[model samples]
Target chain A: MLAFRKVVEKMEGYVPGEQPQEKGFIKLNTNENPYPPPREVLKALQEKVTPERLALYPPPLSDQLRFKLSEVYGVPPDQIIVGNGSDELLNIIFRAFLGYRSRVAYLYPTYTLYRTLATIQEADYLEIPFQGEDFQQLPSRFLAEEADLKVVCNPNSPTGTFIPMEEIEKLLQSSRCPVVLDEAYVDFAEESALPLLPKYPHLIIVRTLSKSFSLAGLRIGFLFAHSEVVKGLLKLKDSYNVNILSQIAGVAALEGLNQVKENISKIKRTREWFSQALKSLGFQVLPSQANFVFVRSRSYESLEKVYQELKSRKILVRFFPEWKEWLRITIGKDQEMQILLENLKEILGKEWNQGA
Target chain B: MLAFRKVVEKMEGYVPGEQPQEKGFIKLNTNENPYPPPREVLKALQEKVTPERLALYPPPLSDQLRFKLSEVYGVPPDQIIVGNGSDELLNIIFRAFLGYRSRVAYLYPTYTLYRTLATIQEADYLEIPFQGEDFQQLPSRFLAEEADLKVVCNPNSPTGTFIPMEEIEKLLQSSRCPVVLDEAYVDFAEESALPLLPKYPHLIIVRTLSKSFSLAGLRIGFLFAHSEVVKGLLKLKDSYNVNILSQIAGVAALEGLNQVKENISKIKRTREWFSQALKSLGFQVLPSQANFVFVRSRSYESLEKVYQELKSRKILVRFFPEWKEWLRITIGKDQEMQILLENLKEILGKEWNQGA
Candidate 1:
């Protein structure tokens, strides 16, 4: 028998939101941008697909992308590192700081991939639950726990609830260990913890182009930190984590930020409208600062049935078993969201009329 | 102070071959394919750059690329896993099998990245040197050393010397532990250990499009192993390691194997010509099966002077500090090789006349 490390043997791989191969289904399960990236991004990609470009190795540290990100975000280029995706950045943090004897802490009902990564490293972790019902407040005990690494997914996934910047600062101030502020969905929100990077040398903010820039398929992500932290993480990263085309696409996406901003505005508007629509139908919808809304019905059984009904109708939304009564719905284009809303209303009304 | 893991603090990162920023140098430092990938690859990439594709998350495991590789390599689709590059695949293997308490072994003067990876994982590693000066035979002690994982870089880098499949089988037969046969440069060689995979369930064959397929910039690699091994490595890889463009490009490259085969034949032919040319110039060139030749001079001082002279003339080849008397030169286009040869002749002649 091939002897896999005990940790790998014991840990289950993270299941990303289902990406049905066949097209035409409403794909709100993964929170990808509902629109394409700016035309310039595609144009840049097309221009970059030459024989010479494809034959050479990419710039090892993605220097061009880092420079563009630095210019856009106001951080020095040396302090930033580009990754294959934000997932790679998160994994690097775990590998660099959290090991077998180290401990990691994150909020419960958050991005579950953190738990999977911590498990893979065989590190002890605390999945501290939110203190309140809205899933907005950080657990007080989470601040008190000592860990080698801490992660905060602002505008956290599955729930789409945003923790305030002040609250995130509190965590950064309380912990001396590395704090990975994953702002994968923060562009949809009002503020970012990127400003905290200079104040806290240990603050590593991870951002991806997937949700806001509409380049998820390109796999471009950035990590902003003190140069010292960046240097250490560089030691652990693959020599050329980001490929050539990705680096080119990332630069073009940043250059086309106006288009990305317009899309973010549209998604934000649709998120608000969708949240209100869900609430009007007697579902409790969390106030989302992301491109998705977390909704719950009063009954777990009925909510699960609604989930299945939506799936049957070829409209896919996210349903985590841990949050039995809650369903996470990504805000697609207005028309797609409208179709989803109509299906939800019919499913719930039919269930209510049946009185089962 | 931000406390990095002890392993990260102590370990120096892998320094990749120098990629000079400015153009116009006779670049042959890294062993990237001098030729461009097939035109079909660029066409596939261009066609894949639509907004809808960019907005969507790539298929998590790159199913299409895997299927294409399966068709070409005759391996089951389930047994093949694609990665950002073979570098990522190697990292996954090190993470899955070799950890803090485990041990790894690889040939000395092989790809040094393996040692760096083991060091990052804080695992003990044994660097078994090749038994002979020609670097054709594997060290006798390598088969005896019990390790959790053993890596063999076929047509090993820097030296470009290949171990025959039968010799590799001897190592596989003696060890029950996982053996990773990295065939990154194998397409340029005469044979691969892939055919042995069926007999040795523990054998993992890693191949990359970077060298032979001329898609290094696209970062596509394939790992072929038993489904059981693939399953374990999957747990450690990022959810979407290969981006959409890379996957599309990989499939197209595989489809255009005829072009790639022609390029490989050209590189091999160039390798032989360059080796013979170097030998005529009083340089000892290793019998190279890969696209690069390892050339050494009898005097370290004179070789160092020659390397500097080549660099001064805007010609770049690889000079490793560890191998002070040796220089690893990548075979470029026939014309590029001709230019490199001319420069070497001039430098050596000047030094001989100077008699210093």
Candidate 2:
């Protein structure tokens, strides 16, 4: 009586962060930009939603937006392929590379979507655990390219720790299979994998406007890779993968680069200050290159209580059961961060003291 | 140096109909709605582009849209899943069902995307060819449950012939695997396979806003199936597959069903008139239930010449090389169709007659 494939039936699938509809919650759970996109993005969106534009099909390949991204990344147009999101690109990569016989490897506690995608494809999943609390170094065997496809999320989520470019290059050099460098958070960090595209034929760098550009609702992402790799991916991509409104908004975000850069800088500065503030409150905060801070309270028991208390106060932050002691909090505006700190101090003082 | 899988490297990808950017041509190649979408759709788009909405993630799984679609289709909320486009839904289906050992079947000269998708998934393809000019029947063996997944495009594209519900039901009842009824153009046709969902748990109906709702540029599409089928698809879908603007525009389109129905009726009328007009000029035409006419001149050589003449007149209609004698002409507005008729008369008289 069962119609679905064995893999789909067995899989629980990826659960995204809860999107609470209850009003007045400080939403810091997902790593979305707290600030609104630039004014120009709205203007571009205004122009694209007209009757004439909505009636026609979008350009299949998103040529104009890809051209704009090319100039921004200083890459050839052939090397760029736009998708509905980097999420779609990840799906396409799996379809093109991994199969029943093939296997995929990703860092343990990385973007969980890769695992979900592999499960959907029914491919073998190899979890490569990072060393210690810093979660930086990978095992030598994991880097030897045992899997058909390998994914590394730079400035990894939940941990907010970035792997250095030198380490990535070393892995790419030794790896026999293609490597995907997911740079979804790289805009907040200093280095990008775009420069390494020409040198490493096997490298595919994925980026998104959901974070740095503050347009998560628009769903735009791009892949920077060698032309040959891009060609294979293009074959697997859905025609008209990117919607017209997203393309317009993406271009507008690119045009207003200075404004977006200012916002990123503000988030980074706030992240640093927020990290120091969390440390002062007797919490262990990981050094983050992304827009979010990953922190753990003084004790493991305190973590669950603090998260619940924060939720009761309508301040939402991400708590993963696997990482029981840790919490991933996105950097919001200064005012939001201030309220968070004040709330944290009150919650920690009352709850931790009572528990002790 | 070759990094892609064997299937990816060996297969020729799907090439969508040409999107001509040159102005003033009677742009009918891709079957896009010639008239603009309803005013309400634009209004919805305008409302959704706000800075605040753009900064956050769209409702994962598009809950609001599915609710609206539920009321319209008289199906429960769980039975519908929205996608970036039906194209994306197609991709998800391949990932969920088809695999290395699985096989897919689709009618020849139908929507070519199905074959391309199966190729991308590395699934074996069984292309069921229609007998003659009117592609009305599928081979009996194709109906037998040989393939893991079967696709039938109702009001079949390129040929524009509609199969009755009885045929669909018979196939569904006999199908050993899941059957996907792609009703991308079903709004223009008289009947759909929607009512069969309750009777056949294996039936999955895919519809798109690209054709009837005239929101192709927005990239909104939906799947109507049994709740169990929808559940399997939900697990495979990207968390935030549909963008905010598309969801808003889709809800608005649903709200403005009257306007969309009026547009569909008008296109149906134009299609009738245009089919007669083509027949008057000694051309062969299949009975079309969709928004376009599938036509071929009396002589095969004359068909290619007429296509070139139409292009010379800056009236672009789709000409599939594989279907060398045939041309798929999207029915535009009355005036546009009239202009197309006059131009066709002139081109057929001059170039096609001269070649004959």
Candidate 3:
């Protein structure tokens, strides 16, 4: 009786990082900021959500919010599109650009969600392995005209590796296909591809308020691109996709720029300190621009044992089974790092002297 | 430069009802509720939103919220699939069930979105028109095994008519297609088809928190069906489609059922009173079970005058140019309706004296 499509049945869904239900855990697992969003964002959202506003449909397109984003990105309103999240924006890219036979390219371990989206669209997924010492470079051949879409996750997830802007520019030369630079962590990174949107009509940069802005619960993100790409996405999206509250919250975040900057500074400082501490614990911490550190475990056996030990001790951190030898710890509050280090000390305390 | 598929180029997009920005006027253009959602809902939402929760990912599939909806609809966890909104769920249905050439059926003057979705998918649309005096009978003959899907919007939008459950049951008997009953306004109606999920595998009832639950600002809705349909939708949906805020807000709403019921009771009373007032003013209003009243504006001149007069006031209402003679007025608060009535009298002030 169940007639799920053959493609979907065979395909594995993308599993997002675990959101721990257990309380009293140092949840550095999913790279979520330990701090709340700017105070103004919450106040603005609370102030705007008059019970009456919820009765009506939210403004379709959130033109005011879009305009704010356009200002932030230094683009015209026509060149911007907002979504329930950047995930929603990405889905539209798949729907608008890719067809059943269309080929889409992305890195293997970048964001697992990309592959799942392509699979759902039933498009061909071109998994490119990261070869260079820095995982940022892609094959020139991957972005050939034959490929309809290519997604690059910069300040890449799980690994926290980055590609230089010049390397990305080189890949763009051969690509007539639309390039999606998912700069989800760009605010924390050195530069943004958003500034390059005017030069490359086919380039679409996905940005989110989930990370640096610390507003993950209020899902809001935007795609900065050419007018045509944004218009195409609008055609494919729900008329009232962004709810009234998110639009309000998103605009508030934009207006409260100084406050958001202060929060990001706090996270960046915490990230640096946490990274240095992990290195001292006999772990190799990847140079990171994002809010998390990826460390290769000293021993594969200890990695699993340490993960269980951390869980048992009620401190949560991300574990990638594929990268069985690595752990991704989010740059949480300063207090959370202390707890994680304490747990790590207990796990490696006995083995530390013998191994080191 | 503009490279979309032939199907994409041919797609005539879904144009939703007008969302006016201007203030001051008896703006009853769209089917929005006259009054705000319950106070308790807003309060609960306000109380739930803190800085830390906002920093974390919302429970993608909130079991607590889902279970509450389960209690309301009497379905198991596996049987219910919630989404950002019912629109997201509908999109998933099109992708999961229909192919480019697959046939689909829906009412002629139903929610126009259904037709647009079919067009976007490049599927054939079977737009069967309504007939009979009661608006309870449908063209059941349109139900064919070859068609992959069928949608029935109860108390149909624009027309403000409803198809009987018997007619829906007849449509279901064909077994040729998955019948989607979109009960967006089911909260204000007599009954819902959720109970039949146990017996009918292909029957899917799409309900929204937007209507009865009064969480439109929070885009959360659920599809109740046998586990098979849920699986099909899950396969097609973008992972993490529902944001965290919507999930938390939805749980708050369901748990606070007393508030929801009170809002519904008040809205229903307001709707009845407003319908009579419009009739007294020599206007024809459709017997609407939903939150809106669809009425025929007497003359193009008067309709034009009425729309402008309301616009001059700070009220925003929806007006359709497609069928210029008809206006769909949502039930606003009694104070708003009183102002609307007073404005209508002013519009007719000269007309009444002329006795035309």
Candidate 4:
């Protein structure tokens, strides 16, 4: 028999969504920003993230990127630790802060990856599904230390349900252990928990440059916590986790925050407009604080027909096999979203009046 | 006080060697190659590791890079796993294979990073120092399963010592646990354990592009193992551990293998010329199989004086505080080595030779 850890052997690994290559596809599968990143990104990479630096090892902590992120988030540089993606930050949190003997809790139908990360860390995993109060309030049984760590996906993934800040604060006040607030989609959310950094040392917020900055290609994600916890993550992180191109691009994106804001506004508008159009049909669209919206299929035939029609039209939307009925569509550019609606209308009904 | 894991709380983390950025300095501190990667690297970045791919999540196993590495090593893609660097690969091996309660061993004076990785993995750490005789012929005590895994830094770092392949085979036959041969600097070494990969299912050899391929700025490494172990690492790794740029450069470098061979030849030639010069100065130089030489200083003063003199003359080298009298110098371009020799000759006569 092969020599390997039982924990690793028994685990089914996490696989991310597909990036289909066929052109003319209105891709709304992965929740990526529809607009390009700040102008500074393309400009600087050709200049500063140049051939010479590519010959030497990049800075261990990526000092400049940390400083820029700290300035934007209003946190000290020492309290910031970055990763290849916000996913990597979450990996470090579970791997370093919590022991395998410790337990972790997250709501089901939230970011499903939390359970996968906890399992990989070999921790006791617990899930309190988003059943009662529409996932707004923490489960009553969870107020006590059911787990050593609790990960709350703010404006949670898949469902796009935005829980109020007060409930999170209340959970923090009574929770048995440290809490991680994953805000990967927070740029499109109503507000972020970054402002709460100073008040709560036990609260950790993870952010990514992927959605808002339009830089999913150059992997850059960061976690903000009490300096002590950040220090713990630093201790566990790979020395050269962030490459030079990313560090340079991250600094550029932060400096040109105006462009980032513009892009975010464009996406936010498209997201709202798309939500209204989806609801115009019989689909029940969840209130989303992310770049993507979750719509429940009214009729099983309609769901199957719409999915197949969109794919045939070279438009892609992610359908979860776990929750087979609901569809997750990323907010594409205005033109792309319009094409999706038109194609969707044709699939639902031939005429505009009959589309409902 | 923060409620972190007790393991990380008491841990004093490893500090990597300094990478200085002084103008006009001939940098031989870290063992980075002097040449830029072949032109194919830039071409691949522009043509393959694109902005579009970045927008979506990267392929988890990086099938393309794995396939390229497998072809180079004459193994199939299933038998390999890629990482941000061999450092991350080593971390995965410890977690997916060695339990925290299990013991792990390595050479004391070899890549000290192996011990650090093991400690971070919470494996019981064991080390056997480099004494006399060939590295392959470890002491009888090393074969015991008290250590669940052993890491052999082939053509070892700091002290460039090479062990015969037969000796490694002997250990695999005798030891109860798995053996990992870290070939991070193996391009500079005379031999590799890759040919024996087919026969030894327990062997896992880790390699990197940081040294010979001239892509230190791009942190990419690969692992070769039995398909079972490779799958195990994949299940345990962070999905996007290797970023877009590194993946692009890795394939190009693999395609340009002849260019890499030429680069390694130049480094080897320079290594020989410089080692002979050091030997003439009465320093005991280990016969290096890698692109660097580890020289023992007769005393702490000699080491300190040599280090200071090199610094003042705009030259840099790595000195281990733990092994205070040993200096590890990377083989630079022939002209850069000349600068180091001239600085060493003038300084040794002035300060290091004063007492002698």
User: Which candidate has the top score in TM-score?
Assistant: 1
Considering just chain B, what TM-score does every model have?
A: 0.97, 0.96, 0.90, 0.94
TM-score, structure 1 vs. true: 0.98
Model 1 ranges with Cα > 4 A deviation: A352-356, B352-356
Q: What are the models' TM-scores?
A: 0.98, 0.96, 0.91, 0.93
Error of 2 at A299 (Å): 1.1
Q: DockQ of each candidate's interface versus the true one? A: 0.85, 0.75, 0.58, 0.57
Model 1 lDDT per residue over A179-284, tens place: 8888999999999998787889889999999999998999998999999999999999888889999999899989899999999999999988888888888889
- How many Å off is the CA of B50 in candidate 2? 1.5
Off by over 4 Å in 4: A21-24, A131-133, A301-313, A343-356, B46-51, B131-136, B144-147, B301-305, B352-356
lDDT of 2 by residue, A1-356 (tens): 53567888889878899787567999999988988898899888777557877888888889889999999889999999998888989988988888775799888888888888887777899988887778777667677758899999998887888888888888889887999999999999889777788888999999999999998989999999888888888888888888888888899999988889999999989998889988988889988999998898765543766788889999999888777778899999999999999998898767564653
Candidate 2 stretches with Cα past 4 Å from truth are: A352-356, B131-133, B351-356
- Model 4 Cα lDDT, one tens digit per residue, A1-356: 46677777788877677666446677788887777777777667656754557778888888889998878878889988878889878988887766777788887787767777777667888877765635566676666655678888987888787878877888888875778999988888788787777888889999899888887767789888998888877777877778777888889989989887887888889889899998887778888888899897556523544566678889888877777778899998999999899888777675322342
Which stretch of 10 consecutive residues in model 2 chain B shows the poorest summed lDDT?
B347-356
Report how far residue B311 has shifted in candidate 4, in Å: 3.4
Residue pairs whose backbone atoms clash in candidate 2: none
- lDDT string, candidate 1, B250-339, tens digits: 999999999999999999889888888889888888888888998887744435666778888888898887787789898899999999
Give the winner by lDDT: 3 or 4.
4
What is the lDDT for B178 in model 2?
Answer: 86
N/CA/C clash count, model 4: 1
Query: For residues B1-356, what per-residue lDDT tens digits would candidate 2 score against the true structure?
Result: 64678888888889888777677888888889987787888887776557878888889988889999999999998888899999989878876788776799888878988888887767889888876656776668778748889999998998889988888888987887889999999999989998888888888899999999888898998999878888887898888999998988899889999989999999998998888888988888899999999888766553666677778888888988788778899999888888888988776555536646
Worst 10 residues of 1 chain B by lDDT: B298-307
